[model samples]
Target: MMAPRNIAPIGYSGGSAPRSGPSGTLGADNRLTTYANTTRRRVDTILELFFADKARRADSDRLPPDIVGALHAHIFAGGSRTRATLCALGWQSNGGQERLPGAVLRAAASLELHHAGVVAYNDLIENQEPRRGIVPLRRMMEFRYVSESLGKQSAGLLGLLTLAWSDELFHGARLTARQRCAAIPVLAEMRADVIYGQLLALTGMDCDLGDVDLALRIVRYKTVGYRYEHPLQLGASLAGANPDIRRTLSAYARPLGEASQLCADLRSVFGNPLTREQPRPEDLQRSRTTVLFNIAAAVADADQRAELLTLTANPDLDATGAQRCREIIETTGAAAETVRMVAQRRALALQALEATPIPMPAAEMLRVLARRVTANIPSSCCLGRGTS
Candidate 1:
């Protein structure tokens, strides 16, 4: 467990909205707006280009008509394109040139595609409907009467293919075969980690009290690896970053990724306003593991814990029952504890940045993005130290 020294959060005081990007149709809102402002023109442009490319690729007769249609719909639906956008931004931050290679754009697109595919899988496993504010792909493609197995399997394989596409983008005669080979292992590991974590979550393994550390470990392996380190490393590697810089960036990325996931988990527990999606307390109804359930399980006494467990374990828990469970988590201070955990991870992320020799602008941009990510979570703001 490596720890870094104190680094205060960079506060954003001005209550001003970000300037609109060149594409005026898309406006900024809250955290996303800042991200849009920071990477606006370039990120937005490349993302549109990527979706266009994926749509084209899916349109080709390479796959069945239904599968391709499903894939296309999944890609174009209202995703934030955060992963791809972040990769592009990371490349720029690392002194990579403004005009990214086609391969780089594809690599970034690979992340978004992979994410979309998994979201579909998540919906199937959790038996939930809704992604990026729209209906889940499972529901979109499923036979209403029959179970959504075929649709889920299709999306799962598509997700697998999208993840594999990341490696294909990096492989070529242009780069040394040895370099390409070296990159494959790291990328594979990252993809595998996410799959395993997702599977654990799907199985409700996150409910076991002793498994919280294991759950965190699962997230660290699955999420922190790809969303932060691997993408940065890939960019750094493409630009020929030194081992020291790679390691330093990894250090900085880990906590940031963890913190980001924590915020997402918080959103999963406490509805997202921008997306206008409420947290599904009955996510476990579809086998989704949640931070709220984990904390409640850990701190609540036996009878109380059993009641919480009943709310989670019971498939019968409807919207009203789910809301009650949500109430219990909040009443028991589990929500407060989760807030503390997110703050701790966020602080750790900032400290890791301090330990490294990153430039001010790049660092500030990321800091702003991090705060915006967590701002939606009221618990995140009240970190128990009165930072709110």
Candidate 2:
């Protein structure tokens, strides 16, 4: 399964095209904004073509129209376009190309299809709602089927179908046979990584939330690998990047990806609960055992520790209990500590970009992405992919 939403999908876009190289003078903010907007538009264009082809293949006698419609709605609903943007950046890294080639864009688009399939599946697995922090895919299906069970079942089926379509898109991306050979292995690894990450996530559900390493591992497997590392590596591989550049990209992605999750976790607990499309705060509800909680657990007195145990993972927790958990987190300095960690990771990611021989433009764009993901979570939980 794959997802921009299920991954640490970013949110925000606006800009115009302007060619620039690693040492180019284009403004970082404007370039990144353009990159984000351009990537989204190109991906949407590819998706539109895909749907048109599907329409041609599926006449009245063929596939039911509703499932495809539902998927269309879910994907177009909008996400951060994180993976796709990262792909574009990777292909262009180290002064590979200025204008993005059509094949490269299609390959980038393939990542989205893959992301959609996995994210759709993730919706079923996570079981938190409103789906994908916006439109609810399963609920939409329920409306079409007029049966809750049927609708949920249809979503799962759609997930499988979308995954198949993702493969189709990948193979159809028009990569040269040489490019295909370079990319296929990474694609295979990405598929395995996402599944393995999800398995880790599902398994970690009832386990101790206090294991900081376990939680970070989940973030790495679920998010860092396929979402950041693989997407970057895949794009770089497609462009025939050397191993050193790929290594640099990996070093940049790992800490930044974890920091992104940390930002989401902070937003989930402390950010406003009334944001549009926001679901019930799942972090405390599910006992996710984020770094914030672990830090509190380590420092708390017995009474405070007992309170955290009672408050988190409590299906029956009320406002009062929730407030108590927040208080413990606040008083024990866990929230502040987590904030510090975000800054720390951000610094590390930036350092990785600087330490390597990456082109300046590529490094700047990657920095722009890092800053976006690790930006201060405001009082509202506007960020998506909530706490795992």
The TM-score leader among the candidates is 2
Clashes in candidate 2: how many?
A: 7
lDDT of 1 by residue, 93-137 (tens): 566764556666555555665666566666666667664456677
Off by over 4 Å in 1: 1-62, 131-133, 143-147, 164-182, 203-207, 273-277, 284-288, 379-388
Name the best candidate (by lDDT). 2
**Model 2 regions lying over 4 Å from their true place:** 1-26, 131-133, 272-283, 287-289, 378-388
lDDT of 1 at 66: 58
Cα miss at 382, model 1 (Å)? 4.7
TM-score of every candidate relative to the true structure: 0.77, 0.86
Q: For candidate 1, what is the lDDT?
A: 0.58
Each candidate's clash count: 1, 7
Local accuracy of candidate 2 as per-residue lDDT tens digits, 238-346:
8899888888898998898888878777766675222432224454665464666776777777898887887776777777777677777777776777777788898
Candidate 1: worst 10 consecutive residues by lDDT? 1-10
